[model samples]
Target: MSKSNRNLFFSLYWLFFLVGISTVLVGQVLPILARRFSISDSESGYFFIAHFAGSLSGIFLYNYQAQKSNFIRTILLGICASATGILLLNADSQVICTIGFFLNGICAGANIPAVNMLVAKLSSLRVSSSLQVLNFFWGVGAISSQPFFHALSSDGSVLLPTVLLAGAYLIAFVFIYSHRLEEKTEESSRVNRASFWTVWRNPIAWITALFNFAHVGLESGIGGWLTTYSERFAKEGLISATPVFFVFFVLGRAIAPAIIDFFDDNSFIFLSLLVLLVGLVVIVFSSSYVGLICGAGICGIGTSAIFPANMARFAKIFYPDASKHATPIFVMGSFGGAITTYSIGYLSDYFNSLKVGIFVLFANTLILIALQMLVLLGLQFPKKDKT
Candidate 1:
């Protein structure tokens, strides 16, 4: 709405946007990492584990000290952490790569929630619209990561992608560092801060957190396995498959703002889940490249709205506590990604079938739907919250 708001938007956008690269890019390139390091799919879980550890720490620590620090100061610190991690990714040693992923996750752990808090706090007409815009930028960033890496891998070089990623963070650092915003007034600060205990006690908070666990895990699981799926079963590279699904995912997010007012939250959830389930079903059944890519697009479209739309609602429901609640949501979320990614790899290896690995996503989506049903029924949930 003002000069400061524009700057915050740019800063927040890149903060989420850049990490989109890691979210999907790492999955697409996992095969390379495994071969280069002589690790198994199960061993690959270590990267996810390292990242999860970092992210879990980030969410908890930020919640503990959020009130004591301003958004800019905390975000800059995260950017530095993330940049260092990204740089470490270039090393040849297996241990170094694992460390790099762990540190890179640490950056996400700190930066993602902090940026989310900043965006939610924007003095806007509707926080829902603001959040949709946030997720849209995230979608765009996610799209960039897949195709960009594929192109580099085609040339048998990841050097440019690494440099580009470093440059993205550097630009973000400079812009975010230089920009200043109006300070929060004392009264607003008191209203905005919520202690962890208060947030943890809310059942809706836990359900919502669990929902994020399923949703993020499903997305990450799909990304981690899709390339392998394409290579082993179909005839294609990771790049071809990722963009098809991600483009639809981007479309879904871009259109989310327009549809929010059109459907009630419950109705929207049903519609999205239905589409998502259909996509996953197609993926499991498809034997051809065309079928797999099509299924990916459907899955992307299905996933597009879940995270952003649900996040917008969380801000509405939790408000002052949203910042605090974000911790558990993401903590469980990291668990979801970590466990699901690791499980799929382990299970796939156990079964000697990539198809078996994908069933994990199928089971996960079903669980997410059941959780949302609980939310809609108002089971163990308060009808109204005091902010």
Candidate 2:
């Protein structure tokens, strides 16, 4: 990579780093936010729903506009939107905070795909490996998030962090907006007119999208609820256990490039899911704080490679149609986050045990494992067209 290319990559990394923090911010602070607003666990699910719903909408927006606009332009817009969301998120009102989360989701929805697509386009030769490296920075952000929150607010108020995050986005916006992005190639510039149905008609496309739905649901459910789960189950310092999970999560991603190279995409995902299942089993069955922490770390490592591997697989399998398929796949991811995160809270409220809620993750993981098995079997069962 040339100096310019390196600069762009770092910028993208920084953006994802910010994205990492935003991704888990609600989950990390869910308890505090609940207390502040005097809301129950089920009510709190609204936050996740609003945020992810906005994210789904944003993905749709990006899908429509990506061909019409440049990646840098979409990215800049997302950065600005994220900053605005953070500022709103810092507000005292719960309604405003919900709106802020929605905007934040929009930012994430727009930028996540935009950044990933940009990297894939730029590093066409090594989509999987490059995405692995790119997502490693996301893990860095996630692992640092709890510590970052603690460092800024001794009382657990999100005000300081949100303000600082908003400021950071402002600075990044100014810099990235002014930088001269590389010119788009003819391939990048071509319009993809395939309708959503066209993409959905492909069995590979729906399966891949559903796989992401399950994968994200599992990942986000764990990240979002682990803190509360610790507080309820193991009498350990909630903060301590939550970050341990993310720490291993980061380490897993950092090593994914090397680890994944040994196996093909389906093989890697299958193996990763098995590890994830083990971790989930440990978490659900374990009684002690040590066991909880250990299970979290194991789960993190297990989950590290699944998303990137699947993304790389999608790119390779879809090739030129990858962009066409990107929207629904990503939308399902956000949708999964919305439904699963909310469902966790709802189930906890219904069953009156966080552990029961967590069973949802366990179930989703099994579904993912089964889905990957089907993919491995080389199923090409596309949806039938109308007669």
RMSD of each: 3.1, 4.5
Error of 1 at 218 (Å): 0.5
Backbone clash pairs for candidate 2 read: none
Residues 107-141, candidate 1, lDDT per residue (tens digit)? 77777777777787773347666777788887888
lDDT of each: 0.75, 0.81
Residue 49 deviation, candidate 2, in Å? 0.5
Error of 1 at 138 (Å): 1.0
Best by lDDT: 2
Candidate 2 residue lDDT tens string, 97-116 = 99988888888888888888
